[model samples]
Structures are given as C-alpha cells and as structure tokens.
Target: MKQLFSPRADRLLRGFGIIGAAALVLAATVGFALSRSDGTWGVGTPAAQPIPFSHAIHAGQIGLDCRYCHAGVEQAADAGMPTAETCLGCHSQVWNVSAQFAPLQTALALGRPVTWSSVHRLPEHVRFQHAAHIGAGVTCAQCHGPVETMARTVKTETQSMGWCLDCHREATPQSASLVAASHAQFGVEVPPLANCSTCHR
Candidate 1:
C-alpha cells in the first residue's frame, strides 16, 4: 500500500518552525541588549555636577553626615541644598584663609546661594523623594555610588525606571517563611515597591 502526504501539512510545519526560530532569536537579542546597557538600561548616563565637589574629603575624611550638606534628607521630600551658611560653617575658618575660597566667599558675602549643578537629576516629569528613600533604609551609596570614595564625584548609576523596579521587586516579601531570605537579599525593611506615584509624581 502507498501513503500520500498533504502539501498543506508540509507548509504548515515549515511555517511553525520558522516562527519558533524567529521568536527565540528575538528573545535572545533582547536579553543580550539588556545586559550590555551598563546599569542605565539604554536610557542615558547621569548628569555631571558643577564645582567638582569631593565627597571623599567631606564624607570620608571629615566624617560629615550626608545630612550636613543635604539637610532636608530627613525632614522634607527633597533634600535641601547646602545654604551659604552651611558652606560658611567651614569656609569661614578654613577656606577663608585660602585664595581658593575667594569665589565661595564672594558668593556668601553677597548672600546668594551657590549655584552647584545637580548631578543626579531625573527628567522634569519624574520626582524623587529623598526623605522617603532615606526613611526606607536606602543608603546614600546605593544610588550615589560610593560617594565617600569619589574625589571629584562622577555619575555612577543610570537611575532608570528598570533599575529602580529591579531593586524594589527583589526586596518585596512573598511569604512569612521567606521573610529572612528576602531581608537577607534585600534589607530588613523594603522601601515601597516602585509604584508609578513613587517616582512619577
């Protein structure tokens, strides 16, 4: 006995194979692209700050708390800029004797705020709350990228949504049994998981 095969069946099988291969290739490409993006997730690099400040000298050597300069980190939604008074606290006695402090002195004397450029600014539409992050146990180093070691601070992290969400998701707890495991992976207390309002507002 002779058996006959349908041409339609052969075409359908070939089509399905081609589609499967294409899907697999697309998925692999996406994964590879994500890995190569370098913590920015292909959005862009962090902004550069003005005045080439040294967190190493301040935070590391001098042992100033992050709150000294960023006074609002604990009290307000936005971490307030160091006022001229704050600068004068040190510049008055230290830089006051140095020619390098001339510009700072001039600004302080004029009662004008130092126009230091923001380094970690998100887009205008996105709002970040410093107090919330600090209250949630997010360390300054996690986002600021080891500021204590940076002499002239540079943009370290990409600060993209994916980066934020990845952190949040990893910290969320599922079951009480896994609480210790989750805390070990994340922290003792996780910040509110990356909700749209958390950053978008």
Candidate 2:
C-alpha cells in the first residue's frame, strides 16, 4: 500500500506539533507567573471573611489581646481559631442583630464555626510551630506585622524560607528567649535557626 502522508509532510507535522506545544507551555508559564505576582495572590492579599470581622475595631479599639482569640498559640503547634462560643461571648451582647453578623449568628446557632479564610498561608511542604515561636518570645507582630491596625486580615510579610532564614540569622529581640529555649531544647548543639532542617521539617 502507498504511504498516506509523505515523509516531508510527516516531519512538518511533527515540527508543528512540537512548536505548538512549546508555545502553549510558554503561555501557561507566563499565566502562572502573572497569577502569583499579580494583586490576586502573595503578601498583602486581604482575605474576605464570612463576616466583616475587623481586627482594628476588636483589637485596636476594644484592646482585646491576641491571646483572647488565639487561645492556643502558646500551647499548640497550630494557633487555633476562635471558637463559636468565643465570638458569641461578645457578639451576643453587642451587635447581635447586625446584618453583617447574620452569618456569625447562623454559624453559632448551627454549632459550627465561621470558616474564615486564611490570610497568612505557607506552602503545604513547610511546617510552622506556633508554640515554639511563642516560647521564643517572637511576638506575633514580628512576622504578622501590626495586625491590630488591619481592618481586614492581610498577609503583610512574605512567608518564604529565605525571608524566614534572614530573620533567624539576625540578632532579634527574641534572641535571649530563643537561646534559652535552645538550651532547654538542644542541650548543647546550638544549631543555627537558619538551617534548612530548622524550618523545612
């Protein structure tokens, strides 16, 4: 039987396919880069919560301490979110009928917590311990910036490994506490906090 396509046509089709694929990959790469670098994602991206929970009004005006909401920061590996009871404790007495708080009331009545969007999220590959940071006297502001002043929660810092190592390598106010914790933790080997194992684990 005669060949359906000439050898030249076969080569041209293969070349076109390769070129088309490369172009598609280039376009996809550019789109992904724009997605990450644009105002859509990365540091300073504000999260819209189910309710308009203002840190400025609660923490700044009312002077509610961080611990009041993040009750497990000093004890748990993860800083636990505020329970529905915690929100109800205040909301039940103040602004209980506000339209903005409708979700809050519904969540409370349903015995579920408001699914607040995460503002400062790290990659799944990395692990962060809130207890260790808290024990080291690294105040929330050291990394989260002045959160009390934010009307809406925003990622103020680049939660990158290099950015973390830079802070760890510096002589911060938490050095003393870190040293103390290190002594209690490591006993003798004073491993640098900037070590890959310090954070990557």
| Residue 84, candidate 1: C-alpha displacement in angstroms | 2.7
In the predicted model 2, the residue pairs found to clash are none
- The CA root-mean-square deviation of candidate 1, after full C-alpha superposition on the true structure, stands at 8.2
| Candidate 2 lDDT | 0.77
lDDT of 1 by residue, 62-81 (tens): 99988888888886877878
Backbone clashes for every candidate come to 0, 0
- Taken over the whole model, the C-alpha lDDT of each candidate is 0.69, 0.77
Off by over 4 Å in 2: 1-41, 94-96, 171-191
Q: What is the overall TM-score of model 1 with all chains considered together?
A: 0.63
Best-performing candidate as measured by lDDT: 2
Q: Per-residue lDDT for 78 in model 1?
A: 79
| The best candidate in terms of TM-score | 2
Q: What is the TM-score of each predicted model, taking all chains together?
A: 0.63, 0.67
Find the 10 residues in a row with the least total lDDT in model 1.
177-186
| lDDT by residue for model 2 (1-201), tens | 888889999899999999999999999999987765635546777876888788999999999999899988999987888876787787776655577767777777798877888977778878788987888778899888899999988876767665777777674435554444443233545346654555665
